[model samples]
Target: MSNTEIEDRQFITIAIKNGLVSKEKVDRAYILQRRIYTQAKVHKPICDILIQMGIITEAQKAQLNAARNVLMGKREEPADEVADDALPDINTARELELTISKDGLQAFIHPEHHQVQDVRIEDLRLFLNRRRIKFGVVDDGQIKSYLSQSPLPEKSFLIAVGQEPESPTPPELKFYFDTNPLRIGRVNEDGSIDWKDRGKLPQVNAGDLIAEIIPGNPGKPGKNVTGKTIVPPKLPKIRLKRGKGVDRSEDGHRFVARTGGMPQLIRKNRVQILSTLNIDGDIGLETGHVEFDGHIEVNGIVQAGYRVKGASIRAKELYNAEFEISGDIISLGGIYRAKIQSNGNLRASHIHTSDLTIFGDVVVEKEIFESTIETNGQLVIDNGTIISSKISAKKGIYANDIGTEASKKCDLDVGIDHRLEREVNLLKADIEKNGKLVQLRKADIEKARQRSDYLNTQLGEIAQEQDGYMVKQRDMDAKLSEAEADKDELQIAFYQKTIRELGEKRNEIDAIVEKYLEEDEGILANIPVYERDVAETEGHIEAAEQKIKALEIESEADPGHPEIKISGTIFNGTCVTSPKATLTTREDYTHTSMRETDVEDGVTTKKFRIKTTSL
Candidate 1:
């Protein structure tokens, strides 16, 4: 990063020593001059010496732009796409122990890159910045020196969060209120967003799961703030406990979000099974049954013929308990006795339930049944068979014996039957797809069509108004023009400007009307002017388009678009779910959509649903 020049006693003295300045050495020297030193430091004689040696080329200047752009994260230029095969062989990166110039601290390579060049710690840190990764730290030379000399040894880095304070701490979590603007409720404050806090609370059954946010970072993207988000089965008057802690994520009270916020906290607005307060003999719990509500703990062996329901319904030593839940069914005892059908997490021990359907993660101790062994979540089979099923998740499936080929996208363990490998490799394909996405002009077409209708009506109203105004102005004009001298102060500026703007609008509207006539008159020309038919009209929609663009340019200093602004980014308590429409009021680049304006300023994020394709 430095640009300094050495006093060139070498160039003159070296030539004196050799009794001549050879072109090759001079060429190399010029390359060093332009690259390493500024023009002022590198004198005219030395610079000319290198250029005269033919070291600098027009091609090198172009290459510098490509090099600088690639470093700055821009698209590569066409010629720069040349393969590295033409370049010199330079792979074998070696580990180099180097001491810092300031502290003389020898920096050791904890994990060496297998390439040829020594990876400077600074370079490694820069590479990590390109990819925003957490859970890593860059300590100064002092820490590195300490680690090198420490008795514990082999420790590359260490970060320690300080202990909790003696005084009570503030809550780091909040539950979102699903209002037009999201109703943010502090987990620790008075919970009255829900009407239940006003005394008329909603009915809560035994199985209903209630939850609140615990300890976690809560930044919502580009915003300069962070807060933990939590939820419950129903949108209750949320009650978040103060400070950082974990509670009630057991039985059916686990912290998780089925959607929104992060995957942290419990499933919002979904039934969760709570813990069992009683485990008795009279409870006829059996296998093949599932619970979405409160805890179920029974003493007897679950009869294979029956099923039970609730949150955390369990049979003590009961193997063969047929437990079925749409989301998660966690069993502490045996299924040897029963088969469990779960759409979510399934945890059981020494059970003989072969049928396991996990739409989520499944960790089991025994053989799985012919339940298609499918899991949209992770699957962990410790002791038994995970037969014929497609496992699909963003994460991996760890197991001992997987009976069949993976039929879908799955991060499977090392061992699998190679015979059906192709079928097992039905991994989800990541395709970056983009087409014309319906013509961009459809927006213009629709806009033009609507404007035509509006303009026609407005023209009629204005015609009457203008005629009346003209009559009144004629009386005034007659009075002024009759007087002749007072005509200059007649204030025609307002009327002139209005007339000019109206004429421009008339041109826009007339062009669209002609386009509609020109396109459709050959076929079904009789279509009504419904204002919506502009997209279907065939004429020079492009001309109408250029006028709109001109207006947009004029709008730059003209108060921009006429839309009222919402203060925050989130709409209706959710960060916009409609992908194309990134409407937000969030200050962090999330612009809240203005319902008042027909088209947003940034872009008409909504797609143009074209009615016709030919033109």
Candidate 2:
């Protein structure tokens, strides 16, 4: 017997192996089939009897038929012929391929054939049975109709469905300011410091929770088409890289600030804490010397002879004290007679000291009187006056008015380069020299032409005189011959003397004409050389002028417009200096921006005009 026939002998065993029917159910169906034959005296297939007795559903029947067809290697009949469902005696089922969605919520089946034939319910059941897919909301008719369209055999149809996995959410970070170690400092709209909430020093106590880290959840597992489990992707751990004065929790999730001072989160991870040493009163013998790495805030005046150093130093009033800060220096009341140096911005109410040097910008609310101030950045006096002070800014200076008529010696300095202006002036001088040389060469050419013309005229006069002398000598010779022939001795002697004298005059005229001709020829020959010289000089002059024009354009293009604006009156004696120029006020100027205009000096370039204008 063929292998198909041999496998078909145990239909119940095949159904059980395909997971469509259990062994116990097959045993019960066999007993019922034997009782039907013995009591009703009628023989019938056990599978048909199991279906009629409601022991097996239509799906199980289809599974048995599909299993038998797979064993016999039978394929579905053509759609134009008899239907597979009508051929109950013969197995008209085909093998099918199964596919599952990514989520495993849907299962699809397709016939394993080049051209799809009509699909029966049995084919779908057998495909699902082999994969051990047990639970799904199956629609057999929809699957059958989908396969009837003669779709490409490799195309999958929705045959079974399953559940999907629920993924987990990641953790997030939360910051706490008031309750935590870091104190929040508020800034007003006018850029004034607010000390209402902040204490003497912004600090965080040790073991204080600075941030909260929420926990993440793991997702539930799902089932795939082959009854296999599907797992969700793993999530990354959430934690900040701790810096000084901060430490991570034991769970490697939460963060704690260990030190006290100003807390700053840098680079999205590191937490830096700076300590603060506050001074409630003035700087004296009681307070002693003060030096800190973080910040210093003095409530009262800073006495003289005290040297203070910190990152940032804030004083209510400073008088004759020396301060060195790497950061900012802010004086709320004023700075009077104090010598201060800072790396960052410096702000004061009124600066009347003679010694203040800052690396950053300096902003004063009131007048800066007789103060020797120097900063690498700008100097800004907001609606304030500047009196007889020597102020220098590497960038520029801006104030209401520099000095009054009484304090006319106030000096203000800005940043310009004098080298560029000097170079431009030198180019202009060279261009002028080249132009003059070109004109001189042209004049030389014209003078050569005039000299040539005069020589030609002299040569013509000499030629005319020589022709007259030759004719006179010839007439004298001819007359002497005639006299000798007539036997006149006295006439012959007179003619001979006249002819000799004419010959000498003609020789002198010929010598003069020859000298004039040589001079005229020389002038004519040198005219072309002189003309070439003039053309070359003209070209050199044009090139030099073009370079000079380019230099002028570069001088105009220089972007050095630094002005000191004053809303009030600027006194005489106030001197403002830029990189390339300096300006001293001659008269009292009112409500004007005192600026310097770039003026190229021939010998020494004056960069600033020291001019003022209302606009």
Candidate 3:
């Protein structure tokens, strides 16, 4: 190539490396220069084309030319020796394009299209230094080998590589128990769930290891192509807070269980062991019939077809399940078709077709439908209906409504002790039996009196016969002394013996009559005693009825009144009952209250009345 051509190429390479102009724009300028030269047989410099095309300004061109002169070691020649457009070249080294990556990690050198001597390693180093790539330069031997090729390689050559920054390792928490223990069961190949294999319950025994902390390292620094330090990010420290029933190791690196119970991870970093089994999800077949000795908390629903037993229970909803809880139960969502027996109070949103026997008070927010509920304390439905259900409360029952127009009949009984009522019924039966016994004793006294009268008449007949026999015996005795024949004397002796036997018979009949009189008196006396017993039992029954009435009156005046208070409509087919009376609705009544009150119908009687009032 001519000296002018080489100088122009050197200026283009320097302009591109300095970011004054892009390689693509310079290439286009070169194409235009070549086309003009071919069409008009004229030589146009690439620098002038680039300037005319607005790719580079004249000032930028001049600057690039100065830098090129310095890089190529071109000394200024005399004006007499060099033409105005021609450049004086003192060296014949090939020019190269240096490019550094955006990350400052790697650099490449592109060989230009020139047939000249190989580039010096010192010049290559100087070129990289100008681009701020002072680190990780290639060895001199490698650069010589790259330059000694038969034809200089046209592709880019990797001249330098920078060190990558090392990142710090993050702190790790390694739990012995499963962190996400409350999960659904595994799925089989046929898309069916293996409910028996519901994920592990993170249970731990006393002194068992629960978790451990793994320390992290602060990573080493790295150097970039500019020889600047790249510091790694700091490792985050993890802290574990010990909760109830949890013990930490002396070094604070290990967490252990202090009691035999389930382990739970709470608030992101706390490790706790709880006596209560905390189920984070639903109680379904996947959880497979929970039976816990302590309290149970279900975050989701207690699904259908599950049996759960616990000391206490708290759930979002209960659906077609059976629960036997010794303590109180709280269900946020409604209960449907569930059978629950709680010794303690029950609080729920609603109850539908469920059977509940609560010893303590029951509070339901919404409606209750087709359920059988018996409570010793009270049943309260604050804002909803008690439709198609049977409710019996010892203290009282309160609800917005008793039944619905389309629902089945609802039966409610309040202000009475069910046990005491049963006892009264038994006493009434006993009273009936006692009255029968009194009648039977009166009949026995009459029979005994008849027997005594018959015996006395028989004694009278025997005495009359004895008197005649005595007269005959006296006549026989007077004749015996005057008799001479043996036959007459024997006859008189026989008659006297007969008279004595008649007297003995009269005495026996008299003794039998006396015994009958005593037996009649005994029967009559027993009749009075039986009658007294019947009277005492009747008195007891009356007393019990009075006590029940008094209790009903007291319950009506109780703070939690033993009555049905309906804020909304109470429909037909609803019956409110007490121990003594019942009130069945015949039509819908709005904002009514039902309670047992005493009414005088000839005698004082307790009756159930529905009074319309604002609730």
> Model 1: per-residue lDDT, tens digit, 261-340?
11111222233323333555533532334443433546554565566654333344445445655444444454554555
Q: Write down the TM-score of every candidate.
A: 0.27, 0.36, 0.34
Minimal lDDT window, size 10, model 2: 178-187
Q: Which candidate is the best by TM-score?
A: 2
Q: Tens-digit lDDT track for model 3 on 51-168? A: 8998776655665565576676674333343332222221222366667888778888776665535566555565565556778888888988987874567788888888887888
Worst 10 residues of 1 by lDDT: 427-436
lDDT of each: 0.37, 0.67, 0.71
Give one digit per residue, the lDDT tens place, for model 2 in 380-481. Answer: 774678887888776577777677666547877765423344555776677677678767767776888888788877777777877777778778878988
Off by over 4 Å in 2: 1-260, 263-273, 416-561, 596-611
As a whole number from 0 to 100, the lDDT of residue 189 in candidate 1 is 48
Per-candidate alpha-carbon RMSD to the true structure: 25.9, 32.5, 48.4
Q: Sort the predicted structures by lDDT, highest score first.
A: 3, 2, 1
Error of 1 at 25 (Å): 29
TM-score head-to-head 1 vs 3, winner: 3
Candidate 1 Cα errors over 4 Å, as ranges: 1-293, 300-311, 316-345, 349-361, 375-382, 386-445, 448-615
